[model samples]
Target: MPSFLGSLRQFVLAPKLSAVTFAERGFPGAGSAAAERLEAIPQAVVCGFEWGIAARDLWEVERRLELVEQEQRGFAYEGAAMAFTVRDAMAGGRGTRTRDLLLGPAAPHLLLAYIGIGFAMARLPRPLWRNIMPDLTGTLFYPTMTWLAVDGYGFDLAYFHPEKYIGKQRVPPPYPWEGRPDYFPRAVDQGIGRALWFTGGAEPETVTASVARFPSERRPDLWSGVGLAATFAGGASADGLARVRDAAGEHWPQLGLGAVFAISARVMAGHVPEHSALACEVLAGSSVDDAVAIAGRTGASPADADDTMPLYEQWRNRIRAELGAISGEQRKAS
Candidate 1:
């Protein structure tokens, strides 16, 4: 049997399994290729962090994030542009089967979950900081990473399976319903742009205003959520915010704060079906008290810990069993 620590390590180091599918399916175009590779980086980072925390080794998460950040910063501007083109192309059609082929059994559910979480997080009230902090920290990271996938690396629509859209090809379908169009593609891009904008040293208000004007179905919700989060966090430094805004505006001004929140929520909630099993296990085993404790340790306020504990315990046991089964299969194969 794998020790908890060993299992955690495996989870963290879980190779870019999704990328293998991308390569196998031959989704042509440089942007498509880049998107495929970029998608893996965040997954690897998140899985590593999740596993490390499970094993009580928090430093690993920091290390992984640092590595990811370095890589993201190093990607060239031209490369990022190519990625965007590919993403847009994929969004139009062409690679639907490629997306399906790569995603296999786990793609649909995972996509829906991400969409749900993103919308949910974006719509959250600003005053609910205590309730939303965990969701913010835990969920936001993934969507933030997705933004990087687009803006930083230029990943395109093929990465998201745009062929699933219904009607005029303008909007993504609603959750659990596969035919709807994605309503917030522009919003997602805008959120990414804003993050880059704020990181660049623009005034927060300027960046905030620019984000407000960017189009999105969830614009009001996203603006409110980001505004609240920024306010609560005391806001980023003016110079820093400007730097981010400058960079984002240069690449994808359409990406906005609300999309970022929504993406993060999706990532945290493990709405992605491929990741659901692991997400469920983590949530089940994790204590609201512990999450609150970790938040306090990180200089954040303590949040309500009463409601999620029972659910956490139940999921943890369920995950333990599932993990055991997977481990057994690995051993047999070996």
Candidate 2:
């Protein structure tokens, strides 16, 4: 992917750093520090995408990505993986760019890298999506984390085409992701929920209100997305996360489920930023260790009984049920 042409491609195809700013995108933000912090997330994505597209080798990309701050480094890998996926797709599925990324330098952050593939999915047509996710036969969370790519596509749609997906609340048609068209929209909503956290500028009132504008049934998935983004991305303070959690009310369990998933990803990355720890304590109502434990305890296996639901949905449902039970226990103790 390294060359003058590749650099030109990145320059032409990727968004400018300025373009990702909240104000540039017309997303709500008071220009507060938190808002600025939130805005940097996408900018990091741009940086990663550029580097990935232009680097001579995975080692070069990996070395360059190390220069990114720890908290945002995974995001750079995310961006790089995105570029890699696009390259692979463009090469008519012959390039090993994306597969090498996941199995090599981007391995630790496989979770975010999966989402990066989804971002590429949004850009490439349905036909090119065939071989995007590399075959990670014995990996810890291959097929499961692949769902995050669908989540990424949802985020991409809502992020770039707010008027259609977010404002008008259009339901995008389903793809048979992992052979489940019925669950595709639900997975996409999870990503849209994540985008809402950013679209509303990490402001609790605006984020929740945006979710509310969507139909009632959709709000739960949306809230969980909010929970995941608001936690993992960390634009809000402790107080702000608490407000986001409290705002969920009946949807609190869904929100907590999202937070738990975020925590699990962070933990797997082998680093937990201060904001994530705070989010776990506040939104997830547990320390990082406990949240990870809850996620692990409720984790579903492909062998889990009942052939009705996909393991991915079953995994989420299990987490929500655990969070719900924990919430119930607290209610009684209080």
**Best candidate, TM-score:** 2
Task: Summarize candidate 2's per-residue lDDT along 129-220 as a digit string, tens digits.
Answer: 77878898888776776899999999999999999999899998888888888889998999999999988998888998898888998998
Q: Model 1, 1-334: lDDT tens per residue?
A: 3357556544653334454233332333223433344334334433432333233222332343234332221111112122222222333423232232113321222222222223223323323211211122343222222222212111122123323211112332222111112323433442343232222122455445544454544343233323222321222443433343343332221122222222333343233222222222222222233322332232211232233332222222233344344436757999
Question: Residue 179 in candidate 1 has what lDDT?
Answer: 15
Per-prediction TM-score, please? 0.27, 0.96
Q: In candidate 2, residue 6 scores what lDDT?
A: 76
TM-score of 1: 0.27
lDDT of 1 at 29: 24
Clashing pairs in 2: none
